[model samples]
Target: MSLRTTLRVKTPPGFRVDASALLPVRLAAMSVAEIERIVLPAGNDRCIVGDVFEVSRGEATPALEAPHAGATLVIENAAPWLDRVGARMTDGHLVVHGSTGDYSGFQMAGGVLRIEGDAGHFTACEMRGGRLTVTGHCGDFAAGALVGDMEGMTGGTLTIHGNVGARLADRMRRGLVLVGGNAGEFAASRLVAGTIGIAGQLGAHYAYGMRRGTLLLTQRPAQLPPTFTGGGRGFDVFWALLVRSLAGEIAPFSQWHAASLPTRYAGDLAVDGRGEILVVS
Candidate 1:
């Protein structure tokens, strides 16, 4: 049998809660009382986890780790103050059944985190590895650099099914970010490397200052910035391969594998100009 833990939010906090303490690694062996005694940040003071969450459990099972079977954490009626819900998790499964606050999966190295409702800012900041899915809209800086941080997501796959706010994937060095809806201003700005696929319209400065990376857009931008220029053909083979890869990731793009070539642009000449932006016809 698998062990499952559920944290039911009883009251919404007026201020934020640093929920990094709830990571699967930390909860692996804790008993009900111990889990409840965990400290959380509530505005200027500290509050016990018990004060806000009612804990419940399923059949007993082993701890959660990579490749290990069946351990789960579920947050029911999640509040916006619950930040960093699964930060730094190296393994296990987590589900937030409602809207979540900022830094939801900050720097997570591995595991799966699924948010069923809207996500606040910095949804997946500086993530190194893992799969994070947001079923609803996300605020600014999703999968982008944290304030003052040098880079954004370093590795992993972040899929958002709804609209994304500004600076999506900024300075991301590696990984894939897929947005099923529109992306805000400076999308993919200053990217060092990685792949970003957006199925809707882009805000201004779509690829501004981007140093490297591939951005796949299903729609055209209001205007292409001066830093970019056309990328001539000779990319047919690359296109074929990319479509095959993307087809498995986003169901809506399953037909992309047979679709015609998209218009390509290269540069952010202000930098290495090695990055590419492709817009589908």
Candidate 2:
């Protein structure tokens, strides 16, 4: 018998499916049949969950026990239009075996959203709390606000193991975002507060209009944005504490705790923003 609840993609979504309502917390008590009967919004029409997915019941294990009790929803295929996979989720585990469409973890509050493959745009948008990990590349506007929303991710840890598209972490309020590879243009634009660590190169116009936040880059940019001006000191203690906290997030950032101070630029004078951009010099 299966050990967890598995949903195999039978037909790719042609329109957006608001699957946020179908979460692990709500499916733990339902039988396989019941879970299959759950309804999900397909654009303007409604479609039964089973109509698009082949459901399989998993054998109960510690994974479904009290502390972790909740049907582990396992997705086997990639569907780009299947938005909001774990939006507003409170608990349980959401494991996507393959790539998924936009809004994969939109406004996700709690629990783990793991995608083995790539993810679409708005990944983890307005996330309040929890852990979201995308093994592959993610489209634009990741960890940022929705179309009209002012704030982006408010809390949680978003780790992207691959490259990210434009506007990464735009207007992010709070959270720890670590990108393993390169980030596109306008990365961390209009940032409010939080820490972002990037392992690879960054695109142009980095940290423009950043109000406040920390952007830790492994490689220095070709040229600093004109809106910022260099200089700030006496942050050794603060940098020490900050690096120690970030040690677990990435490897290179660990050495920063003891490394020489980076060349700090404070501005976004365009907006009179107090944010600082640190370049490893």
Candidate 3:
């Protein structure tokens, strides 16, 4: 049989649900029916599965597992301000039909989060694992680190189809972020490791104080950090593999595989770093 859980909170004022705290652990080895029965917090009182949602049990179908396997969670029409629906989840698949609040996948370990609409700021802050794909635009710090923190995104992948706000990957340590449209200033500031690939132009000061990591651009950048030094020009097979791996998440980037080889630059010599920037020639 299949399992389904639908939220029933219609006009609950100021009632926010912290679904992230329950994920990965609660979703593992459980079916949809089992997921619906789990209790959800509502401010002061507790709510049961039948009280706040409508659940149906059936066999697993392609709709539920279209993106992947594991305990698939399909959230529909969650009102605005429902922040952190799936934070720190280690496994499972979470699908949201509408927009998501801030810190959608903060510190997530594994699993897949697909938001069909826009996402708020700090969308995937400090994400360690898993994959978060947003269809619409996002606010500032799309995949950045915590404020005043040195280490940014550690692991995982964040794919955005629409434009993103400022400081996309500031202080990123490890992981992969793919932006289909333009990005704001300081895109990869102080990036220690990992990669940030943008299919459009970077806003300004694209990479500043970047100690390590790779930033890929599809168009001619208006401005490049002075610290970065030109490394002549060369192609890397690893870039091809990265593009291939992200093809499904970012459809347009697939063309890079057949396009001309890009020019690579190494920089942040101010800190004696080894970060790199790759732009389409």
Candidate 4:
């Protein structure tokens, strides 16, 4: 028998559904009947998985392996009302065929979470470790700290193929975020440590209060804050290493030559002042 489980939505939920409980690791142990009985929070009410989806089992793909005995889980016909699609998932693969609501991969520690469509706000908030990819646009606060939290994404890799909203990585302690399209304002506010790459234009007040981190931009912004200044050099070795490491990650950056160095600005001088912003020529 195949170790893959598929959940096809029978009907779009009229209210937002908290689908966090339906994780790959947990589902891999359940029988088809048991999976159907699983409960989910839908708005102010509750519903069982069988009420909204048709469950089936199929062959597993070689590309994805669970940390242990768990099998991969696939959600088909996913919609924006499905929230927390892979929250706290530790192992295994989870794929969403359509859009998802807020906190799509909240605190994910391991495994792969792939969203084929856009993701809502706080898409990967407080993520500790793992790989999360959103093929379409993402809303604000991705890889950022949640309200009342002191830290954002501590470790992980987040890749967005489309534009992103404001506060892209607020208070991020460590991680890698790549955006293929434009980014909104305050792209790396108060960033403590991490690497953020944006291939398109950046909005106003970007890198505001950034303390220690690297922000790679393919296009120069309209203006940079006065807190930042130029004259950074002697980092050819670091630039070459970075370019080589990112050569397979995203475009423009992936196409950069190791010998070419970009313009560097150091700042958010009002604070730690150790952060660096590299603008590709």
Best-fitting candidate, measured by TM-score? 4
TM-score, candidate number 1: 0.92
Clashing pairs in 4: none
Model 1 bad stretches (over 4 Å): 59-70
Cα lDDT for residue 177, candidate 4: 94
lDDT of 1 by residue, 125-239 (tens): 9999999999999989888887788899999999999999999998899999999999999899999999999998888877889989999888787788898998767889888
Q: What is the per-residue lDDT of model 2 for residues 1-281, given as tens digits with 9 covering 90 to 100?
A: 22367788897656777777667767767887998888898777888888888888765465433244354667788567677888888777778888878888898988888888999999999999888999999999999998888999999999999999999999999998989899999999999999888888999888988989888877878888888888999888877788778777645665565567777888788885688877764
lDDT of 4 by residue, 1-281 (tens): 23889999997768899999999878878899999999998878988899899999877877655455356999999999999989998888898899999998999998889999999999999999888999999999999999889899999899999999999999999989999999998899989999999999888888889999999988887787899999788999988888888878868778988677899999989999999999988
lDDT of 4 at 254: 87
Looking at candidate 3, the ten consecutive residues that score lowest on lDDT are: 1-10
Pairs with backbone N, CA or C atoms under 3 Å apart (clashes), candidate 3: 1-58, 1-59, 2-58, 2-59, 3-33, 8-52, 154-174
How far is 236's C-alpha from truth in model 1 (Å)?
A: 3.2
**Model 3 shows how many backbone clashes?**
7
Q: List the residue pairs that clash in candidate 2.
A: 2-58, 2-59, 3-58, 3-59, 4-58, 80-101
Model 3 TM-score, all chains together: 0.84
Pitting candidate 1 against candidate 2, the one with the higher lDDT is 1
Per residue, candidate 3 scores C-alpha lDDT tens digits across 88-107 of: 87777777878877788888
Local lDDT at 203 for model 2: 92
Candidate whose lDDT is highest: 4
Sort the candidates on TM-score, descending order: 4, 1, 2, 3
Report the alpha-carbon TM-score of model 4 versus the true structure: 0.96
